[model samples]
Target: MMNGWIISAAAEIFWREENKMAEARSLEEIKLDYAWKFGCGRYIQQREALETLPEEIKRLGDKPLIIAGPRAWEATEGRIEKALREAGIEYVLSVYPDQNTYEKAREHASQAVSSGCDVIVGVGGGRIMDQAKASAYFAGEMTKARSGHFPVVQVPTSIATCAAFAPLSVMYTQEGASLGSLRHNFEVNAIVVDLDVIVKEPARYVASGILDGMAKMVEMQNGHDNITIEEFDVGLVTAFTLAKYTMETYRKRGVQAVEDVRAGKLTKEVEDITYLNIAVAGVISGCSKGFGQTALGHECYELIRTHFTQEAKDFIHGEIVAVGQSMQLSFNGQEDQIPALREMMNSFDMPLTLKDIGIEPTEENVETLYQDLYHSPFVKDCPEEAEKLRKAMKWLCE
Candidate 1:
């Protein structure tokens, strides 16, 4: 009688466990029912790629508005004008200020509307593209235009960020502080990546871009355990594969590619690197839809930007992010990976310590940083993890 009772209890426990597993699987399937949208319908990346812009512009419309930064305009004005003239396409040019703010976006949108422009072409770095995207979006809303009818084309002058193909724009305050990001359903009509134009900039931009691309992969890898099997669809898998390719390309040919660009020589390696930096990086983030939620490195950046404005202004996006990645690795108790990460960053003169980013290792500053990190949304779901990250940051400063 005692043996029979024990057997009955074991079977009940096994049944309950199986039920729990089935429930979890059902939940994941429900989540997968939602679909994600991918932006940037067309991508033209190659040397002399600007030559292809006339065809793209013709497809969008006859009346086009060109939005660009002052310096970026100076660099590409000749090619753009020549192309437009040859194609007999009339365009209005609007040069935006250095800042990337909502007000600026609205101002550009007003210009696009008043000028009777049918298509918006953003020609510059990330900020310019972001402004153009926002302008096109708001312009369409104001005019009561159909969705996706008022198209925007992104022509990237630098590979610093994925703004060229991303459907979102990162907003900032008038004081040059980050406000957060804004998402739009509008898709970029096309992307023209002229390697000749991009290589004209310094090699530092390329290196920073590569690191930014790598960060997306690192974030995904760090949070792999949390992602469900249902989330591992073709888009997610392709994103992961692209991230890996970006890292491998950088490790194998990045140094020489930089040298070739510095010498004003555009090689196949440079073209491949640029492709990895812009398209691959952009697509990964676009498809994943912030799957890993930026992990520790980006969280640190947000904290510092919010609290230590003066110190944060001196560093570019990717430079500070590299330091944050190192801190994140340490936070996760993956100290063994730190040496290689630091070495790669150091080779490009990226910051590896607090002082490197212009922050003193004073106790007061460290405490402030810790407090900012503690209250960040990245740790909102798990407050205890914030403490762990704060300790890791403290050790980094020390």
Candidate 2:
């Protein structure tokens, strides 16, 4: 079953060299013209910037629709409403509790359009961001395949995923649980990050974001074996580079870097990490140029299919992806690395094993993963050289 693609000494050398060249390429050096503006003329990071929201809204034109998760509205609604009132801007509020369900997307859009919403502001985590983005699409900001239709302002409460600036949305069934598919209707006109709000969350969530950032690199690299150099996609390259930088940033700084976040201290390093996770990573994923080249943790999708209940999917996206990344490493025949990876998971208090996440490795669970493996699209995309990965996964679970 070994495809005879041996990892000889030379192979490692080649991998190291290629990876080095790939890492050296910068987002600016590439021709992606979309300047993902992160800060508040549209995006405000501080209370002063937020205080100026009224003035800014006056400039951006009149009617605005505030699309956000319940949590986002709960946390900042009063301040937002107060700012709107003081600014004399007319706006309506729409709460998006779910992602890509047809009914939910329709409801949000209809509400915003009916309110004569000319500008859209999305506040909160990835799910809310996605719902806002999808609703904007329905509101005629742009078609699903075109550039943005209307201006959008995004304020991220969590740094856990790249959803804030990305044009893409991960729609879920209504009630906010099951995931549908990745979507890209339009990109954000601006991204606002309040370090204070972000820092207030558990440190573990921040660490999980770091892990998600790292996975962007890991999954993209794993996807590259399927491409040629001329065919090399910018999105994949950007994702890989972002991941590399973010991983190194976390690996070196450890808890102190995260501590700074918890303390609302925005260091140069923290900004870099946050930008990578939010802006750069989002652009890479949202843009069509990178969509085909990117590989997700598809195996995790299958595993979740076997275990995910409506109630469980409500957890943070990073939590699922953290476990997915661990699953990806294991599926790659890197069993020896599990202990190290597990340690990494434990450092963030992430669920380290199937058992930890509440999916016990019982006989039925083992059979399910094996049956699903044969049909896995992610497996199909793996290099012929890595075909043994399928067998390895089966053997490991056995």
Candidate that would win on TM-score: 1
- Indicate the worst ten consecutive residues by lDDT in candidate 2: 18-27
State the displacement of the C-alpha of residue 42, model 1, in Å, after optimal TM-score superposition: 0.7
TM-score, candidate number 1: 0.84
Identify the runs in model 1 with alpha carbons over 4 angstroms from their true place: 1-35, 223-238, 290-293, 380-384, 395-398
lDDT of 1 at 183: 62
Measured against the true structure, the TM-scores of the candidates, in listed sequence, are 0.84, 0.76
Write the residue-wise lDDT of candidate 1 on 124-202 in tens digits. 9888888888788778877888784378888999887778887677656565655545566666899998887987887
lDDT by residue for model 2 (1-398), tens:
00111134643344334222221122333233243322223444553344555565556558878877788777664777887887778888777665545456667777766767777778788767766666666666333324445556777777787777665555444444333343443456666676656656566667767777666655665434432346665544544555566667667764565777667676765666666667656655643243332333534542453245443454466666666665565555455756765576676677654555556667786555545543444455345634555544432332
Whole-model lDDT for model 1 versus the true structure?
Answer: 0.70
Error at 24, model 1, angstroms: 24
